[model samples]
Target: MSNVVNFLTAGVFGGTTLLALKSGVGCGLSGLRRRETLFLAFVYALTALIIGAIAGSIPVNATEQVVGLGVVMHLIIGLALVYFGIRTKKAWLSDRKDISRRTFLLMSLPCPACLAATFLSCLVFTSTTGVSGVAAGGVIGGVFFAGIAGGGAATSWITRKAGMDNPSTLGNVMLFLGLFYLLCLLLVPAYLQAQDAPAFGIATDPSGMLLALVLMTALIVFGALADRIRHTAERGGR
Candidate 1:
């Protein structure tokens, strides 16, 4: 029961939770149909579960292989985020209509953050719960899906209330989140290496935690200031 609770908590507020929230906000800001938004959310959650189940099924002896793969996947994702951030900024500034809700939703489907989180969660669930195979996968996936869907819904609501439907605002949010995810991709692996800890372990490096907190705080502050400046300029122009 405690294990279940922990898995659910991680799903809601874990590092990957940010990805889910970002997807939700993107969906809302893109003016996607209500049904489309819900469909995307469901698909994302289901994908995470399926991936988690597959990861959990891997033999314990192959831990190193899994970690290596995860690292590679994250590296690719980090680079992709950097590219996407630059492109999004350009598009936003140019008032380009190149980006679409379908594209954004598709991209969010295989989020590296979600994949990593699911992988780790599956390992934890298998090890701690002594539940393996399809049944364990189903449980882990269901809980994770619930947590992500719930978080996404909550974030979508908040973003709507904050007038994040504006293209500029949405672009900034996406750029900010992209950078944040990139930072996580870089820092998390280094932290794990430094601690000589298993990727799925609960052990945390204090320095890594502090650095992440500091960086995230700075990103939030910078985003807020940028938004204020943009809004002010718009008002002045009007």
Candidate 2:
């Protein structure tokens, strides 16, 4: 595929990642004024462009080295996230703080999945076409900006309309996203390696797919439960 297409695909997937989705959902619930959310969304999208440009500068041969280093860096971040998740589960379960600017920061961090998409896009672009690094980076940045910003805008609107805004929602999103990231980076990768498969393997393998399904189901359930709890509290107050 062409670099542009690769970037578009990666950008879409990157925006839909658990981290990105949480960023969107959390932003909607963050209690920021609509204008603030808009500004943050734009800034976050700009971050994608910067990251893409940096990623584009690396020679294609360092793919393996980059992947290894990425995994290590992600592991450390994943662990930190998991620790915070555990620490805050109780508050989230009970009082639930509503405002969180942290989601934006967390989402801004280059998670393993997002990095994978970036490198993969770079690889494709470099091999298939002769675009300059700057050109390729611009394309990647533009596409990613569109995906992230568009998704954020949609979520922010839906949240305002549906009244799903909650103080704790953003923190809760961070916890869930961290759990998902840890699961993918720590557990799934080891298992995939043991099975003589590639990391991030989500092909026709029923086992892999089933596990992913379970994880996704958990996220869905968590969102539903949180919303229900908020509604219940509202009714109780009434």
Candidate 3:
């Protein structure tokens, strides 16, 4: 039950899941066909699975090294998110064109948060359940990714139903969400480290997790508010 909870939580809040939501909104706004949207979602899931399998193969003895590498990777992802946000904002202000499907698909592939979540889910499950081996890891990975896909599909459906299919609106939302996601990637690890929590896998410190979640939510709100203010100022200037 704990493992199930962890898997579900990770999938819901993972960066990849967020990316999927963005993808869905972008697809709806861009007038992408249903087949194309599904194809992109499938690509995300497949990439996550591959990342999970590779991360799981790391030996337990190398756990410290993995954590260090994860921190570095998270930093890199954070920067990528910032760059993406800036680009999206620029595109919105200039051409107002929708992002390309190819670019979206590629971005989904390297989602560090999703990769970390899936890897940690597998690690925690195996550690707790006495399930050791590549096969067990693969099963856990599948389960984690299944949750991600479900969340992605649900968000996409909701956005489509809500008629949020405008390119400029979608672009603005993506830019803000990207910044929020970047904040999460950069801060969560540092928070855990400060708490002296477990080096890898899920931190046992509930307070730390709660704090991270709260901070992430706050970041999202901040991003949204900032975007609103910027738009208001622009309109006033005009």
Candidate 4:
């Protein structure tokens, strides 16, 4: 059912982000290459399916339950990345002179914003009345975060490999882009619901999805730009 779809979407987005971050992808607008992008997307979607199913089966209500759970999941993942990045800073320092303790705080900034938005949406919605509602909400929330995580990972991987002093900036910025999309989800639905809306109408709203797409496109573009910048800097140094 819809729950199944939501689960799948969540798994894809979340899984892809983690995988890409762990393994450096590539940079350049052309770097993702059509083949690599498709492959990574497929991998993310499949992983999302497995994880989403397991996460969905925890005897939770569709309302505040799923939303709350999703927030916790996102927060945990975001924090973990910050931690890993912090731990790796020293190791990367010899290569990146500008890497500093403050970078840790910068990396951690997106979590709270995302966490708050997720929690607020659940509370504001205040109703998980049926399977349909649950599925709809889940997809919106799941895809939004997945986009954040996945996109962040993709951008980060590209930047890091491009040898930018602050390659993670790409990922971190993309993560915030995801967070903003989440905020849109929170506010848009509430606005519609308050105005006495139909579930179907809200379901079709493209803002969240569109935002994600735009972000993904931008990340690719920026990745390409970052590569050029790195190349130029290296030449200038010589």
Candidate 5:
């Protein structure tokens, strides 16, 4: 029962609500079977959880190293994901042959935000159950697979019913959610670190502050310019 409780609380519910919404929109956007795509994602996520849990058991501060790596790459990954959203809305189908794959990757692959949640879940489960990392990982990862996949399926169904199963809608959600993630990646990590809080393993220093300020400025400029360009193009014929 403790394992079950840990699975539900730690693994199933560990991910952010925003991430759940992102997964739903991504599933809709992929035009693939949500279960199948998310299954693949679950496989990837489970593998990572197992490996991460085992690594965490080592005497060294593996959490710091692992989460540090994630923090380092999140900005780049966030930018790329936002681009994916934009391109899907504007680009031809030929350019999006791998939308399903990308969606699955978003759901599972090296996502910094999700990675943070995952390791935490693993730690909680293992600690509570006094089980080996491998045992805890399997329990947590299995429940995560079921919960996320189930939620994604339901969300896709709802969106379909609402007539939102289109690239434009998917792209819009992706764009907004991706940007939100960027903001979190940019600011939340350092703030959490400074407070000695959980969530991220980012360094709390002036460099992080400088990076955030610079990148935020760049994002604002690019967003304004792109919005202007898009609006102008829409008004091109008028």
Candidate 6:
């Protein structure tokens, strides 16, 4: 049960964040003219998460070494990701070739985060269980994020290919809701397993989970209401 919880939480936190961040780019590029900031927040949240996970993984003999190394590594990795993301976007625009599903998947690979998450999670998990358990945990975290990033890239490509005429705000709203729901599902189990740990802390048990569900539900509802209001206003021309 504990293992199941851990894996699920890792997946939720890892995967949803990836999707949110990718989608957030669309929102920002859209000039926030009407884009959902929820999606953008999701992106920011996801990036911070992977950063935390990877930084947590650094093996250090001293406290200062740990802090210094984690900071430097994160900076380097963040820059590389931004560079590649830009390049990928450019490639899509320049070639005018539809981003092949395969290409998107290939591009979605989270270079440093995947490796860093695995390494860091492995170290943390290993102390709890054994080397084998840590290895498995690392694999799970890496695969989850990789799949997420890939899926987001694919979705973005498909959305671009589909091309909307008016560009509905609902698209971004749905993107945020979908990612949030998935993340919530993933974390529920993890929160359950970790509930008993003194230092570890489950982070969220039944009440917390319920609260999250309610909050996410509210977000979805609010987003939908906003969309309706916008559409009505546009039709009214004032």
The lDDT values for all models are: 0.60, 0.57, 0.56, 0.45, 0.61, 0.45
lDDT of 1 at 233: 95
Candidate 4 structure quality by residue, lDDT tens digits, 1-238: 6686566545544543443333222222223344444454444344433333344343445544555565565545544544444333323433554333333333323344333333333333222323333443354345444453455456556565877535344344434534544454556665776688774255444686577658856864785577678778988999
TM-score of each: 0.64, 0.59, 0.58, 0.30, 0.68, 0.36
How many clashes in each candidate?
A: 0, 3, 0, 6, 0, 3
Stretches of model 1 off by over 4 angstroms after superposition = 1-19, 52-56, 96-103, 193-238
Best by TM-score: 5
Error of 2 at 39 (Å): 4.0
TM-score result, candidate 1 = 0.64
For model 6, how does the per-residue alpha-carbon lDDT over 1-238 read when each residue is reduced to its tens digit?
7887578556644644454344433443232322234443444335534544454455565434543454454445433433333334334444543322222221233434333444444454554444454344444444444444444444445556667311232233334433444564447447656666453333556687678668856975785577568768877995
Candidate that would win on lDDT: 5
> How far out, in Å, is residue 65 in model 4?
2.2
Candidate 3 lDDT, tens digit per residue, 125-209?
Answer: 5555555545444564444344434544664666668875444444455455555655666467667677777643444466765
Off by over 4 Å in 2: 1-22, 44-57, 83-99, 108-120, 190-238
Candidate with the larger TM-score of 2 and 5: 5
Instruction: Please identify which of the two predictions, 1 or 2, would achieve the higher lDDT against the true structure.
Output: 1
**Structure candidate 2, residue pairs in collision:** 97-167, 98-167, 98-168
> Which model is ahead, 2 or 4, in terms of TM-score?
2
In candidate 3, clashing pairs total 0
TM-score of 6: 0.36
How high is the lDDT of residue 152 in model 5? 65
User: lDDT tens string, model 2, 1-238?
Assistant: 4667767656545543443455455455555556765565565455555555566666667777777776776666655554454344435555564225554455444566456656656545544566654555566555555554555677768766877555444555556666676666646665766687764453355587668769856875786688689879988999
Could you tell which candidate, 2 or 3, scores higher by TM-score?
2
